[model samples]
Target: MPPDYPYGDKVSEPISAYAKRIGIKHETVRTQCDKGILPIIQRKKGTKREVNLYALYLRAKYKAEQFIRDFES
Candidate 1:
């Protein structure tokens, strides 16, 4: 598990907290989730999105390959 995972190695995190942890704009995370480019799970019904930190780590560690595959598929 990543030591720097948002909220101390949480399996999942809210878009805002993830953005803060990674030092990016919260809206960007939200947009990515909304576009289904980021792996995410909805919390309950009508709640904000929660992203899988491990998936996010994999995506960032590898970068654009994920985007390319998603775009192609």
Candidate 2:
């Protein structure tokens, strides 16, 4: 049954997925992290290792609101 998933704490997703979840494009996330705007460690596969979830959440929330306001009028 698909390993009986969603049964516990979820494993961290890939950088692209994380970025998408946070309202940032995959490339934008890569670039920002590369430029050190957000602290990110590299994994063995040459990908971002960790990112601040709260900061991502804040950015996503703010951008979502802004997008809504821009269209609401």
Candidate 3:
């Protein structure tokens, strides 16, 4: 097992924490990472992977809500 797995030695937060916090399913997060939309995971020893936290997703939920508000106005 990787020493930095689930929670890394450098980070208290794991990828799953952020993904789930952003309303993404854990499985979907893995799938998206595999599909290349998410950051390319770096292979760690003992089968763990690391994601880049600096990667920003183009969040559109707020935009869609604003659009609806504008349309209804």
Per-structure clash totals for the candidates = 0, 0, 0
- How large is the C-alpha RMSD of every model relative to the true structure? 6.2, 8.7, 9.8
* Residue-pair clashes, model 2: 0
For model 3 the local lDDT of residue 43 reads 59
Q: Candidate 3 regions off by >4 Å?
A: 1-13, 43-46, 57-73
Give the Å error, residue 57, model 3.
7.5
Model 2, runs deviating above 4 Å:
1-13, 44-73
TM-score of predicted structure 3: 0.46
lDDT per residue (tens digit) for residues 1-73 in model 1? 6665544657788788888978999999888888888899786889777888778767776776778888999
Q: Tell me which of candidates 1 and 2 scores higher on lDDT.
A: 1
TM of each candidate vs. truth: 0.59, 0.42, 0.46
Candidate 2's residue-wise lDDT over 11-58, tens digit each? 345568768777978888777777888655456675546655545555
C-alpha lDDT of residue 20 in model 1: 97
> Which of 1 and 3 is the better model by TM-score?
1
Which residue pairs show collisions in model 3? none
Q: Evaluated with TM-score, which candidate comes out highest?
A: 1
Error of 3 at 55 (Å): 3.3
lDDT of 1: 0.79
